[model samples]
Target: MAEISAVKEAWEIRQRFKPEIWFSAPGAKHYENRYYANHHHSFVNISVTGEACACRCDHCNGKLLQSMVGTPTPLEMRRVVDQLLDKDCRGILVSGGANSQGEVPLLAFMDSIAYASQKGLKVLVHSGIISRETALGLKAAGVDQVLLDVIGDQDTIHQVYHLNQRPEDYLRAMLFCREADLNIAPHVVIGLHYGQIRGEMKALEMIREAWPETIVLVILTPSCGTAMEGLQPPNLADVGEVIAKARLTNPNIPITLGCARPSGQYKRQVEILAVDCGVNGMAYPDEETVIYARSKGLQTMFTEECCSLIARNV
Candidate 1:
């Protein structure tokens, strides 16, 4: 089913435009019987709260956080950093499960963040809904980038996030990052409600107003244990539409198809469409798109650093 769609979508992409994409999947992948693989940036989320997120959002079943490296203490964090440093890591996306107030307890570990920076690890954190005070702490700690998932609608927030947050709360969080002079990279999950496109465009507009340095477009992936397991992800056409809107809205800003989007040709088609839509760059670009972009006019490059906030210089 996906292969047939990819064939059709490829013709559409060639007719419209060719955009750059990066593939961030670990191990290996093949699309339409052609090998697609690349060495891209990798992140070790040294989680402080393990898999226990407070929000328990409708789209995520608490399975995603389990992939992060669990580190509950400063010493444990240091150990993880030490290993990543030895391996010459480009950066780490320090993240964890949120607490009841929609917060990730990363502020308390400023010293650990500082330690990682001192050892030459560029650190980016996925914070929960935050206050100015917390943002200040992250800045003082030398965090290279800070990422937050921002929902645009109150219904999505209430129904999906199961929290009492208004959409404005997400705006406040974006400004908090802005005021602290940190590189802000906000994520807007596409098809967050069983693969629906509700509130996605609003999320893009919020990003434009915030003027974030980078935006990550991670889509919803179903987990078997969650309430939404039986639900399907939003269609590639819908997600592609949102990505095109985001690119047109924020032309210069970098947009990434993060590692969390739906798999198979849904991944390839959305990624290929991302390049067509004028995304500045992608974190883990698909191999076919990379080859095609080079064939067109883009100067495709690879780096081991986190794809979200890669500086314009490189």
Candidate 2:
């Protein structure tokens, strides 16, 4: 009952403002919104590590990498970029598994990222906890955007990601990105603690301090081959509360629901809540979500691109 009240309060608060609904699902995602829309052949995700991951975090255990295009080396990444360009792809998300220390080995690909940017492809990187030097290097390389997952609870970091770093370390990383003048996006996973809500609002408060160009909210979606396969998923109402708090905290910043989250009926409910909470955008939304948003007289648009690109687009 408390959860329902919170959801209703947030929904009412959000309806007082005009909201925009964005649908970004790259690589052949097709949907209809007054017209047939598809995102395939325009945007793609590339795994810089192929299938290799060191940390093998409890939630993922590297299973997420299987969905990305594997590009294990700088040359391979560049080659893949060429193929994507040939297909007239608009952008690419360069991501990979992190090392044991929660760092993705992205330094080696700096030159390739610069090359891709020079070739007119929008490049975004999922760089984990990185050094100041790396942040500056990414800025110099002209990478379009950088995504850092911010965790507010130390236990969540240590137990879930198995990292020795503290929550302050994540804040410091965001500071480095800001110092480097890079377009940075901070992602807060709503239910990262084994499908339980933990410190998510605190994470948002921390991001408010940094004032990033954009913020992304993604929920924990347990994969079948991972340790958390049978774990209970996050509650839709709780996820809605986080989104509402984020809206209250950073009214001017673009808030988006990223491509990762629970699916089926849960996804529909959560997406609807996100819209009601005044989120700026959503990634890979269902057809019904678009219809719902339209029914509420909200502005809606679709792109065959990444949700992070919403910052650049706006």
Candidate 3:
């Protein structure tokens, strides 16, 4: 009952500020429903490291990279960008496997990224633990946003990510992006510690301190062939609590339910809770959730771009 009241309060706070909600379906995956169909080629994802990853995090183990377009070299990245442009692609997410030190090898492909940005592509980079030089380079390349996973617990960092880094290290990376004046979109994965809510709230607090352009919350979706394949996702009530607290803490920031989450009924419930909790946007939202938002008298809008791109307009 207390959790229910908290969600209600959060919704009220949201209504006081922004009454509109946005649904996004990026081209990374095919999505269609009664409400809308995704633009199959509007946006795309690229992997600079191919199927390689040094960290090989327990939850992902580089399997997610298999679905992305492989552009390991600068030349290949340029070629892929040109191909995407011909397909009428409006944006591209340039991501790759992180190294043992949790850094994506993005510096080598800066020129290609710049070329894509120059060609009017909104470029979003998944920078794992970034350095100042790389941050500055990305900013110079005119990248649209730098997406960084902000883990707030050192134990999760060491155990799941297999890194020697601490929570402060993640904070420092955000500071680097801030120094470079790059638009930061920090992603906090709920139940990253093997379906346990270890550091998500702390992660949200860190994001509040960093003052990013947007805050993205993704629930853990145990993937096959990974260490967490057999694990259950976090409790639905807990997921709602985190989303509600995120809304309450950052009343005006654009909080989004990102694309990485569980499917089926769990996905449906989370999407409904997100709408009730007052998230500004959602990625790949369930069809019924869209109808529910309308039933509650909330204005709705749909976009074919990544949910994080909503911050660009804000």
Candidate 4:
């Protein structure tokens, strides 16, 4: 009952501020439905490390990098950017596998990143446990935003991510980005700790301290080859509680249901709960959820950009 009331209160709070919600379908994934079809040729994702990851975390094991365009060298990255420009791509997410120290090693490609930015492309970097130098370099390259996954449990950091670091280390990365005056989008993965809710609230607290521009919440979708391949995701009630708490914690922040998560009925239910929890936007929403949002009197808007870019109206 308390959880129910909290969700209702969150929804009410959202209604008081705005009567609209956004659904995004970035080009990272191919999506089409009755309500909206995404032909987002203007956005793309690039991997600087190709298919390599020193961490090889339990949930991903570098499998996620396979989908991105591989540009392992500075010249290759520049070449890809040129090709994207020819294709009329306006934005790119520069990400790659994390190293042993849990960093994405993006400093080496700063010149290429700047070149892309100068060429009129919005750049967002997924920085894993960044350093001060790398943070400043990203800022210098004119990167529009830095995305970090804030983990609040030391065990999750050590065991799941195979990082010889503490929760404070993740917090320090956020602080580095903050000090660089970069737009920080912190992602809190629900069920990150093997389908259980551990340290998520603490993660949220740390995000509040960092003054993030947006909070992106994603679910742990078990991959086939990873250690957690068969694990079930967090239950609906748990997902709802976290979403509601996130909205309540930052009433004015643009919280988004990001692109990662399970599909099928779970996806539909999660999207509905996200709207009820007053999430500002969602990525690749189910067609039924779009209707559900409209029935609740929300003025639905659609976009082909990443949900994290909602604040900039990309």
Candidate 5:
């Protein structure tokens, strides 16, 4: 099949770069005697708004928020973080649905984040289109890092996110993080244009220019009950091409495949190709990928935290 052939070709082309294997699921994943050593209760995600989002993009329709434990107020978030720390959680990802401006109103929760940090919890915030003032607040709060999605295509921003903002808005946000001297891991969602590859390379170029602490590459997963539900995933080879370009553009920066993508055979195939295409790490990779990496005589390791933390951990 063409898909199989494309994967093989990409694999052949990917041998030039050294590879690093990552196993970053909060829970342990075992394959035979080998296991990804994870702190099952070490890290967790919390949503500020339970099952609610103003953007409600075509691909998500607020479904992604359902998986995150929701806390609507600073007091609630503080209470939840205390409970999680009591249970031995190492870090927490503070996330929520964005408002109409594609911003997660995190200013209101800054005090809670600071409180968690003071109580010795590593804090990571998914800050969307933040202002310099807000970025400073997050920095003063002792937050570990921030995650911001960078979209290169203007049309994708409008059509998929239903936002009138331009790519410059994203670039400016990264600048805000930099001005605050905050650690940031900028994410670029591949194939966000209705399951078709678009602007990934441009986005990578922008990220490379920004010089982020780390870069996370994720693929768009069309969630159920959304307009993009029936759309097929982009070609694995095309995804590989984007990865290859990213490697070439930012050779020193750490790039990892984040824990968001299509599942089943498609996911397995993409993982194998991702290893070859020079991604430094992967979040929750398939067992066969571990075997393949070992067979290629590459050293591998695992972490219980999110792949975005590789920059800080590794």
Candidate 6:
């Protein structure tokens, strides 16, 4: 493992890390796909309104949002949840683009989720950036889990999100959720600085200030029609380094590799590194990582459900 002290070190690590990154390839497919089948799952989203996002960040510009069934209104969301239950869908993760204030209008869907909960549909939510009032409302709605991005640098905050708020605001939001007793999963994106682990470690340090049950680490992938198209992903070892750090820091809490991690060898590498670092579970993991975990004497499983399930086991 390297110190990850400079971009030069990251570049050097990237070239050397590729060979070792292949460790995740063993658990390639089918063997563990069922782990998420009957147990935990999430509906892929498409579209970018009501239940979709508007801000569409550079790494993902709402293209992923298109997979979710359209729910443009509260009642519409209720109908969709009903349909989901009829289809035997596990539950739903409600998210959308940010409003002008950089917050998702989650209050609109809270009551509707309460109704869905009655039908045995668990609800996990992604509130891009939030205020205290909304956090309280989500807790009152009986929401299952809440995920928020915790940023460390004000520069990445303003440049990437195009919103100006101190790191304290995000800290406040996470603390608020804890106060309301909401199951919180804070996210830290690696290589947000054009393919380097700049703000990620800082995010972990910041999260240590609060009480999120779990923290999901995902690497940024450059998407077309955006500012970061074609930029390489962060080194796999860098991803592992952070995961190992998070594991050592909170030994008891669950750390997950979220759905948006980089694709191809980088993706496989991430899965393998997760095992070495003692990751409890993974979301949509590449086949290789699963195989590697088994070889290393770890029990492997996959889930389409949100990473918060990791909290329950920990």
What C-alpha RMSD separates each model from the true structure? 4.9, 2.2, 1.1, 1.4, 3.1, 6.4
**Alpha carbon deviation, residue 110, candidate 4 (Å):** 0.4
Report lDDT (CA) for all predictions: 0.72, 0.83, 0.90, 0.90, 0.81, 0.67
- Candidate 1 weakest ten by summed lDDT: 24-33
Model 2, 1-314: lDDT tens digits are 12565555655655544555667877735454554367567878888899899878788998989988999999999999999999899988888998877878888999998999999998888988878988998999999899999999888998888899888888888999999998889999988999888879888888888889989999998778788998878876677778888877776777899988877888888888887777777888888888888897877877777787786544
Which lDDT tens digits does candidate 6 get at residues 24-73? 11111222443333322234331126435556666656655555556777
Model 4 weakest lDDT span, ten residues long: 305-314
**lDDT, residue 46, model 2:** 86
Give the deviation of candidate 1 from the true structure as CA RMSD.
Answer: 4.9
Rank order (by lDDT, best first): 4, 3, 2, 5, 1, 6
Task: Give the runs in model 4 whose Cα sits over 4 Å from its true position.
Answer: none
TM-score of each: 0.85, 0.93, 0.98, 0.97, 0.91, 0.84
Clashing pairs in 1: 19-275, 19-276, 20-275, 21-285, 22-284, 22-285, 23-284, 23-285, 195-233, 195-234
List, residue by residue over 1-314, the lDDT tens digit for candidate 5. 22454445545544544554566775422223255556656788889887889998999999988878899999999899889988998888888999889989888988899999999987889987888988999999999999999999999999999998988899889898999999999999989999887777777777776789888989989899999997998887788878777766676677788888898999888887777666767888787888877786667887777788887544
Over 4 Å off, model 2: 1-19, 28-35, 312-314
lDDT by residue for model 1 (88-187), tens: 5657878888876677888678899889988877788889798899899999999898899988888888887888888788988999889999889899
Off by over 4 Å in 5: 1-20, 27-34, 37-39
Candidate 2 global CA lDDT score: 0.83
TM-score-sorted candidate list, best first: 3, 4, 2, 5, 1, 6
Residue ranges of candidate 3 with Cα displaced over 4 Å: 312-314
Error of 2 at 120 (Å): 0.4
